[model samples]
Every structure is written in C-alpha cells, then in structure tokens.
Target: MKKRVVITGIGAVTPLGNTMETTWNNVVKGNSGIAPLTRIDSENFQVKVAGEVKNFNPADYIDSKEARRMARFTHFAIAASKMAMNDAGLKVGDNLDGERTGVWIGSGIGGLDEFEEQHKRFLAKGPKRVSPFTIPMFIPDMASGRVSIELGAKGMNNCSVTACASGANSIGDAFRVVQNGITDVMIAGGTEASITEMTIAGFTNMTALSTNPDPTKASRPFDKNRDGFVIAEGAGIMILEELEHARSRGARIYGEIVGYGATGDAYHITTPAPNGEGGQRAMKLALQDANITTQQVDYINAHGTSTYYNDLYETQAIKKVFGDHAYRLAVSSTKSMTGHMLGAAGAVEAIFAILAIKEGMIPPTINYSTADEELDLNYIPNSCKETSVEVAMSNSLGFGGHNATLVFRKFN
Candidate 1:
C-alpha cells in the first residue's frame, strides 16, 4: 500500500507579507502587492511596475555576514524553511530521525542578482574580481542545499528546475519521496529572486510582462483587458510528512496531498498548447490519481498569469477536464494579487489551496471587471466567499511546456 502524505506546516515570503498568516489575511481582503519598481531604475524599462516584497529586512531572517554571502533568493528560502519547521512543531534537537527528514526546493532562475553584479565586476576589473560565493549563489539547486545545511536535514535533498512549474514539481516530488517510504518527513517547496535588469529587459522585449502603471490593475488575470504577468520575487515552503508519522508525533495537520500530475506540452517554448492539451492531461491525471471525480473538486487556483494566451488556454483546459463542473467550481487566480512568483508561484498557490480547505473561504481574483466571452468560469470576482472545499486543484504551466497539477484534500 502507498504511504499517506500530509502537509503539517506552511510558510511564505510573498509580496503581500512575509509569513503565511499575514499573506492569507491580505489575500482574503483582496489586497494588491503590485507596485512601481523601486529596486531598479525603471525609467528606461517598458514594464515599470512589479509585485515586490515591501519592507523586507533580511536581518530579521539571517545574520548580516551570512546574509551577504548568499543570494536574496536563498535568504528567502532559508527564512521560509525555518518558519515551516517551527510551524510543524519540530525542534532542531528533537528526537526525530535526521535521516528521515529531507529538503526539496526549486527556483526558475536562481541567484540572478548575483550573476548580474559579478558580471559587472568582471567587466570593470577582471575575472578574479568575481566573488568566491558566485557559484553557490547562481545554481538553482543551492536553494535546497542551503536549507538542508542550515537545518541539518540529510535524508533526501533535491531540487526541481522546471521553469515556472519548479515549485509545484518540487513539492509533488517531495510528496512522492515520502509516500514511497524514502523519507518520513520532508521540507518541500520553492523560491525565486529573478527581478533583475536582464530578466526585465528580456521579458519586456518578449512582451510577456505587464506595462500597466497602476499596480492594482496590472495583473488582472482572466479579465477581458488582461495584459500580462507582473514579475515578482518570493518563496513559499511547506512541511510534508507521512500521515502516520505526523499523527504519531501529534503534529498539527493542515491538509492531505492526494494527487500530483506532471506533463510536457511538446508544442511551444512560451505559449501554451492550443486548447491547453497538456493542462487538461495534467488535471485529468491528478483526478485519476486521487480517485476523485470532477465535481468533488470545489476550488481551482489557476495559473492565470494575466497573459492573454495563459488565461484563455487555462480556461479551455478546465472546460475540457471538468466539463459541466467547470462552471460550478470556484476558480481564482491569486496572481491577481501577488503577481507571478515564477518558480515559487505553484508553491504559494498551493498554500492558498490548503488555506481554502481549512478556512472554508475562497480568495477572489481582484481587478476582474469585464469577463472574456471565450473564458467563462466562476472566478469569485473581487471578494472572498465562505464555502466548504473538500478538494482543491492548483495548476502551474511553465515556459518550457511543463504542466504540473496538485490536488489537496481536506484533512478529516
């Protein structure tokens, strides 16, 4: 028999807030995290706005010297991982088996800030001018490696680098490792910090980012006037444990991870497959994995990036998978509030999914004024709603045609 997997704790470093509680509160209130880009000189950039983590003081999470050695993304990942472990009621010196705990994390473009700075130094001075920490800061796997070293977790350490699908893929892979008896407890999720000159210029050139000046109206996913995703930076981490292990240790159970599905489009580099064939397959696979019917899923946190192609194709995928149930499901893109966290998007949205199951409330898709005729779904526009969600599905589609879906069930 397959071992049961359950989520025991959650943490987040998001644009709206640093902790999960604060972020969820703001999300339910339909608050916007998007704002004018202040970190960089945006005068020349076409996309002048973004969803930035406001007032984040790295000192609060790491030592001054240690903080300087790592990339900002690693700082976020370590901070979030610490919070998650504490939330799960696990102490550093506890009797838990060190070999039973592992770390699995993801990031789309890791340490972009470090790369840009070092490259500038190299050009101005010489190759030797680059910092010794450059290699550790730039690799995507360093996120998980740093977390494991910080916490002394040694069971299984891995990182998934599936573009925007990185987080969900990481979390799902961690769940599988524990479920398959490789580990009893796992620290799983994703983080990203790619808001840099090159990323912005490239995305702007590709016209993949929103140029809307007004922060609140910039990332209006599924809306008729939806333009494009607003680049954001953050991390979301969660604690996953075998059901029996958690229950035996008296751990606080948040929810159960019931299903996970991953696929590739094999169609396009950036755009989703026409009619969302990959997305539909992922959703169907998740439903089958969970042994649940379409109607059983009460909510769907869409990968609605506010891009025209993404929103439309996601809607098409939902219609194809859920059929009549699509109209009845409460689908919302919290990206409307947090913008897009790239690699961390899926993990953060999964946190929302668990919260919806626990609180019996569905977060709204803010700035949803006019609906598109081709895309019609109950998006819970502009306000939160109270409803019991037995099961929830969160989808993430990436630039490399990667499609990932995760299903969470309310813990009884």
Candidate 2:
C-alpha cells in the first residue's frame, strides 16, 4: 500500500510579514507587500518597486557570527525552518528519528546579492579580497544543506532549481520521499533573496519585470492592464510527515498532500507553450493522481505571474483541463499582493492553499481592475470569501518550461 503524506506545520518569511500568521492575515486582507525598491538603488533602474522582506533580522534565528557568513536567503530559510520544526513539535533527537528525516529546499537565483558583493570586491581589490565563505553563501543548494545541519537530519538532502517552480517542485519531491517510505519526515520549501542590481538589470532587459511606478498596483495578475511581474524575495517552509508518523506523534495536521504532477513544455525557454499544453497535462495528471474528478476541485491557486503570456496561457490550460468546470472553480493569484517571489512563490502559495482548506476562507486576487474577455473565471476578486475548500490545487510554472502541480485535500 502507498503511504499517505500530510503537512504538519508551515512557516514563512514573506514580503508582507516575517511570520506566516501575519503574512496570511495581510494576504486575506488583500494588502500589497510591494513597495519602492529598497534593496538596491532604484535611481539607475526602470523597475522602482519590489516585494522585499521588511524588518528581517537574521540574528533572531541564527548566531550573529554564523549569520554573517551565510547569505540573506539562507537566513530566511533557517528561520522559517526553525519555526516549522517548532510548530510541528518535532525535536530532532527526541521525537523525530534523525535518520528518517530529510531536507529539500529550492531557490532560483540563490545568493545573488552575495555573489554581486563578492565579485565587486574581487574586481576592485584582488581575488584575495573575496570572502572565503562566498561559495557556500551563494550556491542555491546551501539552504537545504544548512537546514539539514541545523536540524540534524541524516536522510536525503536535496534541492530543486526549476526557476519559479523550484519551491513547488521541492515540496512535491519531498512529498514523494515520504510517500515512498524513504523517510518519515521531510523539511521542504523554497527561499530567495535576489533583489540586486544585476538581477534587476537582467529581468529589466528581458522585459520580464513590471515597470509600474505605483507599488500598490504593480503586481496586478490577470488584470487587463497587467504588464509584467514584480520581483520579490522571501522564504516558505513546511514540515511533511507520513500520516501514521504524524498520528503516532499526535501532531496537528494541516492538510494531506494527495497528488503531485510535474511536466515540461519543451517548447519555449521563457514563454509558456502555446495554449499551455504542458500545464494542462500537469493539472490533469495531478487530478488523476489524486483519483478525483474535475468537479471535485474547489479552488486553484493559479501560477498567475501577472505577465501577459503567463496569465493568458495558464487560463487556457485551466479551461482545457477542467472544461466547463473551470468556470465554477475559484482561481486567484496571491502574487497580486506578495509580488512574484520567483523561487519562493510555489511554497508560499502552497501554504495559502492549505490555509484555505483549514480556515474555509479563500483569498482574493487583489488589484483586479479591468477584466479580459478571454480570461473569464471566478477569481474571487477584491475580497476574501468564506467557503469550504475541500480540495485545493496549486500550480507553478517556471521559465525553462517546467510545470508543477500539487493537490491538497482536507484531512478527514
């Protein structure tokens, strides 16, 4: 028999707030986290706004000396991971079997800030001037490595790097580990802190980022006036445990991860496949994996990146997968408020989906002013809706044609 997997705890360091509770409260309120770009000097860039993690102090979670050695992204991951472990009431050597626990965290552009700083030092001074910890600090997989070390987890330590889908892919991959009985528990999620000069320049030149000066309305997903995605940074982590393991430990169950589907468009490097065929396949595969019909899906946390093609193609994918039932499902983009968190988007959005099931409240896609004729669906616009979301699906599509879908069902 296949083992069952469930989420026991979740933690987030988001642009809206430092903790998951605060972030969720603000998200439900339809508040925007985006503000004037503060991480980098905006005088030289057209993109003047971002969703930066405000008031974060790494010393709160890590030792002052140790925190200085790691990148800001790793700091967020460690803090969120610590919070998640505590929330799960899991102690590495006590309740949790250290040998049966693992960590899998993902990031798209990991430690870009650190890399830029160190490179400048090398260019201006000398190679000797570069920090020795630069390699460990800048690599994308260090988040998982550091989390495993901190938690003393001895099992598989892995990281997924599927651009924007990194977070969802990491969670999905970790879910499979527990489902396959490879491990009893897994700390999984994604983190990113890439709000730097080089990142802004690259995305700006590619025309992938929003140029809207108004921070409040910059990340307007599915809006007719939406131009591009607003770059953001943060981390989201979750504790996934086997159903029996959680039950035996008397852990608080948040939701069950019943299905995961991952696919590749193989069509475009950045833009989605025509008609979102890959995304359609992913959603269909997820529903099939969960053994559910399209009508059973109550909500979809869409991968609406606010980019014209992403919103349009993702909508087409939904319609293709659900057919007429797509119109009935509540689809919303939390990115409207949190901005596009790149690598962290999937994991954070997953938390929102699980929260909807736990709280019976569906979050809204704020800043939805003008509607498009072709993209018609119940977006739950402007305000939160109180409803029972028995089954929620979260989708994440990445730049390199990577598509991942996860289905969470209310634990019985």
Candidate 3:
C-alpha cells in the first residue's frame, strides 16, 4: 500500500515579506507587496513595478562567506529550507534518518541576475576577472544541491526547472517520493531570484509584464482591465513527510497532501492550450487521485497570472471541471498581492491553500474592481473570507505549457 503524506511545516521568503508569517498575515490583510522597480533601472523599460523581496540578509541564514559565493536564488532556497526544517523540528542524522531525508527545490531561471553581472564584468574587463563560481551560481539545480549539503539530506536531491510550474512540480515529485516509501521526509518547494535587467527586458519585449506604473493597481488578475503579470522573486519551502513518520515524531500537521496532477499542453511554448484543456485534464486527474467529487473542494488558489489568456483559460478550465458547482466554490488569485513569484508561486500558493484549510480563512484577490463576464466565478473579490475550508486546491501553469495541481485536505 502507498504511504500517506502530510505537510508538517512551511517557510517562504516572498515579496510580501521576508518570512512566511509576515507574508501570510499581509496576504490575509489584502496588502500588496509590489513596488516601483528598484532591482533594475526601469527608466529604459516599459515596466516599472515588481514584487521584490525586501530587507533580506543572506547572512541571517547561511555563512556570510558561503552566501556571497552562492547565487541569490540559492540563498533563498537554503534560508527557506532551513526555516522549514526548523519548523518541522527535524534534523538529518539527529532526529531523522539522514539517508531518508531528501530535498527537491525548483527554479525557472536560477541565477540570471548573477549571470548578467558576470557577463558585464567579462565584457568590461576579461574572463580572468569573472568569478570562478559563475557556473555553479547560474545552474538551476544549485538550490537543491546547496540545500541538501547544508541540511545533510542524504537521499534524493533534485530540482525542477519547469518555468512557473517549477515549484509545484518539485513538490508534486517530492510527494511521490515519500508516498512510494522512498524517503521518510522531503524538503520540497521552489525558489527564484531572476529580477534583473535581462529578465525585465525579455519580459517587457514579450509584453508579458504589467506596465502600469502604479504598484497598487498593477497586478489585477481576473479583472477586466488586467494587463499582465508583475514579475517577482522569492522562495517557498515545505516539509512533506510520511504520515506515520510525522505521527511517530509527534510533528504538527498543517494538512494532508492527498493529490497531485501534472500535465503538458504540448500546444505552445508560451500560449496556453485553448480553454486550458491541459489544465482541465490536470484538475480532473487530481480530483480522481484524491477520490473526491468536484463539490468537495471549498477553495481554489488559481494560477491567475493577471494575464489575459491565463485568467480566461483557467476560469474556463475551472468552469468545465466543476460545472454549476464552480459558482458555489470560492476561487482567488493571491498573485493580486504576491505579484507572481514565478517558480516560487506554486509552492507559496500551496502554502496558502494549506493555511486556508488550517485557519479557515481564505485570502482575497485584491484590485478586482471590474468583473469579467466571461470569468464569473466567486473570486472572493477584495476581502478575506471566513469559512470552514475542508479542502483547498492550488493550480500552477507555466510558460512551457506545464500544468500542475495539488490538493490539500484538512487534517483529521
């Protein structure tokens, strides 16, 4: 028989706040973390705002010398992973079996900022002036590599780089590992620190970024006037452990991870399949995996990127999956506040989903002033909702046509 998996701890370093507690509190309060772009000079670009992590001190989590040598994305991964391990009250080779503890973190564009800087240095001076750690800093898997080393996880150490679905995919894959009895505990989630000139320029050129100068009004997912996603940077980590392992350790459970569904559009590199057909399959698959009917889900954390196609297609997908019951369920896009944390969005949103199940309060989709008739689901517009959330689902759709969904049930 397959083992059961439950989430014991959560950690995040997001634009809304540096720690998971602050981020979740701000999200519940309907506060925006986006601001005028300070990571890069926006004077030359059309986009002027972003959800950038603030007041982060790398030395707070990792050795200052090692932190400097590693990339910013790795810093986030290590910090969030440590926070999660601490919250889970587990230490490899101490409280838990080192060989049974693993790590799987994801990042879409691992360390583009570092690469851009190194490229500039190489161009300005010579290759000799470039840092020797450039390759390690730029690799997407470094986050997982560093975390496994730092935390002494001797089992699987892997990273997924599937664009926006990176985090969700990582968590889902890790879930499989634990469910199959491959490991007792797994550190899973995603991290990204790609806020840089190149990322901005590329996104701006593709018209994938919001050009609204007002940070307050920038990221408006599902709003009729929504323009585009506000690119952001962050990391979200969670501790996924076998239920028996957790119970044996007396670990506090946040929620039980009951289902995961991942799919490929195979339609386009960037554009979503029509009506989000792949997304539909993913949701249906997740429901099937959980052995639950559509009406059982109380809330959905949409992969609402504040983009025209994602919002419309995802809404259509939900409607198709849930039918009339979709009207009864509440669906909200936390990106309205978190501003699309790219690779980290899925994991962070999953954390929000579990929290909703645990706290019975669902975060709102702020700046949802205009309602799109085509997308008429209950967005829980503009304010937090207090209710009994028995089950929550989080969706993540990535640029490479990756679609992932996770289901979290209230722990008994």
lDDT per residue as tens, model 2, 1-412: 7899999999999999999999999999998899999988899899999999999999999889988999999999999999999989998999989999999999998998999999999999999999999999999999999999888999999999999999999999999999999999999999999999999999999999999999878988998999899999999999999999999988999999999999999998999998999999999888999998999999999999999999999999999999999999999999999998899999999999999999999999999999999789888888999999999999999999999999999999
Off by over 4 Å in 2: none
* RMSD after CA superposition, every candidate: 0.8, 0.6, 0.6
| Candidate 3 to truth, TM | 0.99
Runs of candidate 3 exceeding 4 Å displacement: none
Q: What is the TM-score of each candidate against the true structure?
A: 0.99, 0.99, 0.99
Tens digit of lDDT per residue, candidate 3, span 91-177?
Answer: 877789989999999999999998999999999999999999999998999999999999999999999999999999999999999
- Weakest lDDT window of 10 consecutive positions for candidate 2: 373-382
Candidate 1 lDDT, 1-412, residue by residue in tens: 7899999989999999989999999999999888899879998898888988878877887788988889988989999998999899875458468788999999999999899999999999999889999999889999899888888898999999998999999999998999999998899999999899999999999999999999879999999998899999999999999999999988889899999999999998999999999999999998998888998999999999999999999999999999998999999999999999999999999999999999999999999999899988999999999989999999999999999999999998
Clashing pairs in 2: none
Candidate 2 has an lDDT of: 0.95
Candidate 3 lDDT score at position 55? 92
Model 1, which residues run further than 4 Å from truth? Answer: none
